[model samples]
Target: MKPSETVLEIDLKALEHNYRYLASKVDDNVKKLAVIKAFAYGSDSVALAKKLESLGVDYFAVAYTQEGIDLRNGGITQPILVLHPQSTHFQEIIDQCLTPSIYSEFVLNHFIASAEANQQKNYPIHLKLNTGLNRLGFDPKEVPMIVEKLKQTSSIKVDGIFSHFAASEDVKEKEFTHHQMDTFKKVSDQLIENLGYRPLRHLCNTSGILNYPEAHLDMVRTGIGLYGYGNSKEVDQQLIPIGTLKTIISQIHNIKKGESVGYNRMFNASKDTKTATLPLGHADGINRIYGKQNTNVSIHGNLAPIIGNVCMDMIMVDITGIDCEEGDEVILFGKDKSAEVFAHNAGTISYELITSISQRVKRKIIP
Candidate 1:
């Protein structure tokens, strides 16, 4: 309740609302896969996943097998997809009924053996073809051969063919984006024609959903957009921000013109100022790069600039001439400032900011 000993509040209703908003964006033919990986973008995946399960989310996606297991343990019966699964967890995956994105031959073989050993007949799997991002997914040249090999397997089933869009939000780069889309379509066609048939054929992230409706063939995997950050600034303006991150000012200090605050005296008061120190720092996922440039805290609904270097467990904000004192509430990030703003300061995206948040911060599920 106080600023210094702050708690990060998560609105489950807001989470549900955001889910429904993105769900509304999808055509009836397309199923929405809620991306809850990385602790649901550092907002507590277990709790959010439960609420999402109640909301009838068509599917859930996690980055690894462990996250998927945690959801299953928490009683999430909805289909869960592991985007970055390990071969060691192949048996566990079959036991838990988890879907995995097959990217390469190594993963395919492990999954095939695990399925066969477990007598898993037609266990659903998604084929991730590398369009152009080249971060993950199977190369285009490997699709035909991989399909032929999977035909030999008895238990494994190809459920979907998917890929990622690197820059669907940038309309100026439409040519390059379309090129990737074209390549993906061609490879997907080849896989389906050669392999016989697959259930779902998708190639859309949030931005792609808004830009190219044709890409939404079967299902869509959405991460940041569902959490209310948006595909990009321009597109998200219409969407309500669902996450509100708050902290508190622990102490207030008045400094003379020459007095300094924070580590190594990085910030010396050029004029008489009232600075408020927040019990939040890079340790809480507020990266140090947020200091000095484009970084500030919201105090009493007003923006307070962060001064000096952000400490490991605290940050100092210039709250001069504002009606504020110790134990006042501060907004590190939330609906008001937006996570994108914080990402902009850190030279990253909201997805990274949320995923990178440390586990030390206390997350409070709020109304």
Candidate 2:
């Protein structure tokens, strides 16, 4: 295979393993919804969704309607849930058969009006309850009003009801997590009692799946976990990271003591040092904060400390005593260092690091 300057290698086998691993955590009856938002967390959404579709994933979700449309255009025929649908996209959502997650009275009414105006019948949608996240979702007190509004319209159907967990991974916040679950249950039960039937109810994200099995409810949504992270050491050990960020050393420089490297002269060679310049930087999602001797990249199984401010298009790493030349492979965050570890060194989380990878970077699938 030909090489690229910077590439994200996605291991399909590892992705499948992660899906199955998360699947194994819940009961057979519980459906798994693959959250592929943010381009599958900066992998390839269409490609990843295609893989998951073949694996019999019960449902797929994206953060917006356009992402769902992208999947549809990419030949994904499975049911898609739009987690945060907008009023203007109702027509497209209906035209494409994408289910919207209606969270507010304004959104709910706008969608109902759109459905009625289009003369659509039983259009499917998911209801999002606030349940303490408070980012989006209908308030619990509005449940009855929402149900009544739905009853008045033959144009829309509630296929599911769900909520986001504020912090299911934090053991110290166990009580708060349970409280959110309880609130979801109360709100969902009230809707069911009024509507005379229960839509699918889900409340667990990836962390919730690992920590709160009982709260899995009717279905579970797996996002970061499906990309091979468990948010903790023990759980992460059981999962395989699917994406590997790699690049090649563009050049090597032998600098004498007192010589500076990269912008702002942040790194000065105290001793005669050999440095390797890599073709990756802030533009490729290597955050600026990761520079100034804050992060390291692995070359030839050895850790090479970053020596200066990460540039817009390149970075210099101290490669002294390491037998590496230009064109040698350098692993930014992959099997050697792991995204979690790399992100931690930068004072951030793996999710931010992975999703921040520039779209210009090439993505290759490993079969």
Candidate 3:
């Protein structure tokens, strides 16, 4: 059935396929932690998380405390790691049973204080190490201080230690990635020696899982992979894009040569032109960069170039010589017209493009 309005259709079967394909990359014993932050990369997080939970994924991760809370409220019972936690939300995090990633001295100290005040024992917390990402996590030199602080508190226990990859997908940066892996290994060994136990050590993002299998330590974390993007043309073939952005043609016009269309008259018909207006624009997710023939939408398997400046709520496309009409279904991006191709046309990446879709846009889940 064709959707009457603009919708981001999320395919659960494609999601499951991506998950199982990624699962096949690692051994059965290595735990899989699915990253469902930013509303599951702007596709429904709760729904995707629920589906992954049923698939027996070992863990889930979110970018903030509230995201983890949302998962919990949505009835997700899996262990969720708050990747970038703030000091102010310590109590709320504890109240919601969300494990936090202690990335620095400030977070580590604040979390310990919060846990102690609440009289919580062995509250699980993950230590994030700075392994060249330099975005977050404690530096390698801070390991001694970190271990000392842990000895001083029973309120919080290090349940896991992980790091982020700066560029695991780039083969040119393979040397740097190996350096990060070596650093993480050194830090983990030191921590285990001092703490007398080993926590789950994971350093793989989606690319790392596919490119460097040896780095798949006790557990592996995957974000974009589960959502159907593998960061490269070759690996992308092995995955399936789970979200499809679609809309309907709202109106059509037949204009003579020299007639202008859309805001600013950016598009003037050089010849008799057939134009179609779509019910989506920059306000939805299609950035203005995609306008002026930068990208094309699929109408009845034919291509129609976006013909003018993108407006707040609409965009006009040149359907000249194409078989299309008002109320006809349009494929903005999907399996046939991939989001990667759509984003590439506008000089962007899939992550930014897909995640940029406004929350106001309706979401429809499919089999």
Model 1 ranges off by over 4 Å: 1-4
Report clashes for each candidate as comma-separated counts: 1, 0, 0
lDDT (0 to 1) per candidate: 0.82, 0.93, 0.93
lDDT of 3 by residue, 1-367 (tens): 8879999999999999999999999999999999999999989999999999999999999999999999999999999999998999999999999999999998888899999999999999999999898999999999999999999999989899999899999999999999999999999899989999889999999999999999999999999988789999998898889999999999999989999998889999999999999999899988999999998999999988998899989999999888867899999888778888888988988998889899989999996
lDDT of 3: 0.93
Q: For all the candidates, what are their Cα RMSDs to the real structure?
A: 1.7, 1.1, 1.0
TM-score of each: 0.95, 0.98, 0.98
Clashing pairs in 2: none
Evaluate residue 99 in candidate 2 and report its C-alpha lDDT on the 0 to 100 scale: 95
Candidate 2 structure quality by residue, lDDT tens digits, 278-348: 99889999989888778799988999988789999999999999998889899999765799998898799
Candidate with better TM-score, 1 vs 2: 2
Tens digits of lDDT, candidate 1, 1-367: 4634656778887787777877777887688888888889888898988888787778889999999999999889999989999899988888899999999989898888888888888999989888888889898889767978788987988888888888988889789889988998898888888777666877888788778877777888777877786766776775666667788778899899999888888898889989888887888888778776357778888888888888889888889888987777888778778888877766777877777667888788875
